[model samples]
Target: MMRAELAQNFRQLELKKKLEPMLPVLDFIAWSLLKHNQDVVSQLWVLSKQQSWRTSKSIPNSLWNWICSAVDEVTLDPMTKHAWLLLSDD
Candidate 1:
């Protein structure tokens, strides 16, 4: 059990290392989507409407819902929340 847990942790660490290099590109994509695509925000909202934390089916599902809920529960606006999602590695 300990070995399995260690392997899992290592795998997650490796994945993060691989993805870290893409941060800049990801930021650019988010920025472009927000700036050039007026429909992106609505699309995100529409997608969220169809999506729920309870019914999420992905591995580590409900990530976005968790984020949005946390944001909504706080003082941030929609734009800032969206920006937070784009900037956060999680």
Candidate 2:
């Protein structure tokens, strides 16, 4: 499913040497998050925090704003919309 596809994408990125020094940490975080079956918002939050900490700077507001914009562009079904609403409520 989505987890397998994401893992494959990560592997492809890694093979291109695009991840570099952050690869191990990013991979571990991604796998752990996927294993826990966390929601997309939660995963993004954790990844953003990790990226900020790894880079020794606060994550840019623009990055999160962009994520929001991207999410807004998706045409969610009823169940998905409900899930998104619940996440937004939190």
Candidate 3:
């Protein structure tokens, strides 16, 4: 059991090392999409990137979902919204 746990831990650490470098790029992409009023969590977009990640075998499935979810949860403050559109109910 100890050996199994040690192996699992080692594997997870290696995965972390591989995936850590990707976090900044992922975050930037998500931020840019959101800034441009695009959806980061869109199925169409997520599916498009799957092949590359799968080919590299770096990013796991759950990580993609989590990144999308994290990006999706971010809301642009109204104060920071562009000046082009005036918000009114009329």
Candidate 4:
């Protein structure tokens, strides 16, 4: 039953950075599904797809454009820098 619950909810923590100890859980999910005659490849394919875009709230194009333009690009003035300050090439 814990395996079934993990299988249902694991998608919420599937990213590489989030799942250091999750390999066994993933393996169990896949093996359990295979044992039950379910399609493992398709299930993995669905899990592998990026979900970041779906979780982020969608803003209208106009709003996005306005937000992007709200900040003015500023260049550092070397003449105004402190003598000991260093600037690195970006």
Top candidate on TM-score is 1
Q: What does candidate 3's lDDT look like per residue over 35-67, in tens digits? A: 544454455445766754544445555445555
Better of 3 and 4 by lDDT: 3
- Candidate 3: stretches off by over 4 Å: 37-90
Query: Candidate 2, which ten residues in sequence have the lowest lDDT sum?
Result: 56-65
Model 4 compared with the native: what TM-score? Answer: 0.22
| lDDT (10s digit) by residue, model 1, range 1-90 | 799999999999999989866654654465455754545754674476478453324322233443354344335455557644544333
Worst 10 residues of 3 by lDDT: 36-45
lDDT of 4 by residue, 1-90 (tens): 698798767666566547745544554565446644435544553465444344223433433443475578778878898899897777
Tell me the TM-score of each prediction against the true structure: 0.39, 0.21, 0.37, 0.22
Worst lDDT run of 10 residues, candidate 1, spans 54-63
- What's the lDDT of the predicted structure labeled candidate 1? 0.55
lDDT of 2 at 9: 91
- Please name the candidate that would achieve the greatest lDDT relative to the true structure: 3
Ranking by TM-score: 1, 3, 4, 2
Q: Could you tell me the C-alpha RMSD of candidate 1 in Å?
A: 15.5
Candidate 2 per-residue lDDT, tens place, 3-83, comes to 999999989988777656565566455545564554675566667667764553444444344446546444545555654
Relative to the unseen true structure, what is the C-alpha lDDT of residue 47 in candidate 1, on a scale of 0 to 100?
72
